[model samples]
Target: MRIRATVVAAVSGALALSALAAPAAQASDDAVSRADIAKVREAAHAASSSKAAFSARAAAYDEPYALNVTFSNFKIAKAVKVGTTNRVTAKVTYTLTHGTDVDITAFDFLTDPFLYKGSFAAPQNVLIGDDFGHCKSTSATKATCSGTIDIRPRDYELLNADAGTWKAGAWAIAFNGEDPGADDFDMGKVGYAEKGGLATTLVQRYSKLTVNASPEPVKKGKTITVTGKLTRANWEAFRYAGYTNQSVKLQFRKKNSNTYTTIKTVKTNSTGNLKTTVKASVDGYYRYNFEGTTTTPAVKAAGDFVDVK
Candidate 1:
């Protein structure tokens, strides 16, 4: 009934200037007032409500039921050799609340076409469904189910073709099938559905990844240098490319300290290597790891300790 998520707000401010002493035309005297602006805003909200009413009606017939899917421990297996099937498992689970025994399915599609090996190619579709017929609310508090769904290379191709490629990782799973209509139940209250479900398309989505370190043994007031090396491994089967020249950060933490410090930002080499240096005035051993941006993974490396000499 109530969803709590961020709703972006757009703000527009308009400024009007009037000159010519006493407006040559009567229209000049009719400047919009704050109260008038409020009225317009009220009217806009009303119009929005009216449009929403229509959407609700359409959704009534189209999305008769609403099923929310979630995931836990969602993971993609390490990349496999090219031309091979790269698989990721959802450890998926779900709960059906108030639906007319509907068969539900979920998947991923690509938003654009991609070129691979000198040829235009498409991605595969990952399908999620249950053969169990129409589900109804249990007199019991909750219902449950659990299983691991695997994604194949062909599935990636279909997803790429459909443009649902952005649905990668544990975060991109989607739901398909008619909304079950109007029943309400707690999905996690039960053991099976507790972990949640994931979209199958999230298995393969990595490219241009590397790890780095800094200040081998940083002492107080000394500058530390950090560096990263590119593995240069293409996860093509997983819809990922191997490229260097990536930008990354070096994260540092003083030994026995509760928080980590950001040392410097740098970019990887054409071969996928990044290096940077920073000064540390504190006296203690420091831990280091490669910082990640939206596209890269956060990786921690072995820590080296340095004493103030």
Candidate 2:
């Protein structure tokens, strides 16, 4: 099945702030007093506490600044076959209207797969461009970024195990003041924007099937044996492994006819092996059809012909 959906996140209003600039003091020739050193230590502790509080607020989605950022042209793969080395690339264009003279330092784009209870697991952050150069500003107000993240077998397994929808979105961190570690810089002056409505898609996997019918020519009343195996992708090992205890349909197509009819339903054994018997009556073809589960896609094996004399 093919899925196409887009979710948009819009930002309204501008972020504004005002603060007083610290006056530079002249150098003193005398040694500093112990009381002055204690005051400096107290001020440093206060700054650390403020930074922690700001981080807590951002985590809770209560950031005070309303970033004037817009995201567009975000794209992601609809589905990926299960594999440890599999990866998905997400691309997006963004416009930052932070008035004039505001430079964006860094940003992150993330994907969060929702759980069965309709909440999100920990988000996976994508790597943006080469050394984060893709986000370089084309102008003062706009920039385009593209990045890819590995989708490990564990990610697919989680989606398959949970059988739910997954969401991809963007989060941005913009710095307006000096570098973070500077004594004159304040963490509260930073801008944080998180926009979660981008794209939603399902995670699906592929299954493998094989079938064979022995004794090409048999007597009219002879018992014919049909054998097959059912297996699926083993993402961790990057190989196909047996899928046991799954129901599959045995089908037959008479020669010179355009249709295949279900003969009987059979289940795979512990080794994903199948063995069934049918009476030879006419010249026809035999095959296996898998209806598939939520995590796997439906598949049908090529027909094997048998002739009755």
Highest TM-score scorer = 2
Per-candidate TM-scores read 0.39, 0.55
C-alpha RMSD by candidate, in order: 20.9, 13.5
Residues 177-288, model 1: lDDT tens digits: 2111225322111111111122222232333333433444455677766555634223334434433555455565665786666665566667665666657665444333
Question: Candidate 2 at residue 235, lDDT?
Answer: 52
- Which candidate leads the pack in lDDT? 2
- Range of the 10 consecutive residues with the lowest summed lDDT in candidate 1: 13-22
Q: What tens-digit string does per-residue lDDT give for candidate 2 at 1-309?
A: 101000000111111000000112111322322222223223323333457533323422123233445555556665444433445333334433343434554322111111111322223212122112135556777666554422344333232343224454544444443243356544444444444446654445557899999788888889999999988766545567677899999999998987999999999999888889999989999999998775666789999999989
After TM-score superposition, the amount by which residue 267's alpha carbon in candidate 2 deviates from its true location, in angstroms, is: 1.5
lDDT of each: 0.31, 0.50
lDDT of candidate 2 at residue 26, scale 0 to 100: 13
